[model samples]
Target: CSASSGCGTGILANYFDHYTVFNKPVQSGIAVGDFVTLEISSSELFSRAFMLYIFPILALFMGSYMGMRLFPATELWQISFGIFGFISALLLTKYFVK
Candidate 1:
């Protein structure tokens, strides 16, 4: 877990922990029946993490820059723009994933 990125797996696990609707059961610690699977490679995983984490940060910077240009150099407006940028990045990420 330490040698590689496991945050995505951790997120899935936490989600499953709270919502049993997607949980599955195995009788002998083995997949014996219909099971869901995903075909993802390590490189793809890393790329996804990179996009998810870095894109928002980049958007934040761009948003702050635009905010500075459009509004007064006030802390509140800068933070608001940062948040808007993050949300826009998230929306874009969702679209890309689909």
Candidate 2:
């Protein structure tokens, strides 16, 4: 959407400028029309990032540990349960994001 009406254009522009994949500097004042944008605070973005990235790994580790504890001699069970836990964490994250 155009910033002519003074929406969140600045915040979005600044975010893109600071956080591009190639680390190239981006100019501000870029605008898009017909594109939906959700406004979120930086802290919220970081929190969500942590949940999206870190939570699944942590869940996998915990799940594998628990699986091992439950089935000490079964290596397959540990791997299967770890993968299951990771997927479940991701699904939960998707549901909460929506």
Best by TM-score: 2
Candidate 2 TM-score over all chains jointly: 0.59
**TM-score per candidate:** 0.55, 0.59
Tens-place lDDT per residue, model 2, 1-98, is: 44635766555565554443333344566554434344579999998988888999998998899889999998998998899899999998988864
Q: Can you tell me which runs of candidate 1 are displaced by over 4 Å?
A: 1-12, 16-43
Error of 2 at 65 (Å): 0.6
Clashes of 2: 1
Candidate 2: where are CA atoms >4 Å away?
1-39
Task: Tell me which residue pairs clash in candidate 1.
Answer: none
Worst 10 residues of 1 by lDDT: 17-26
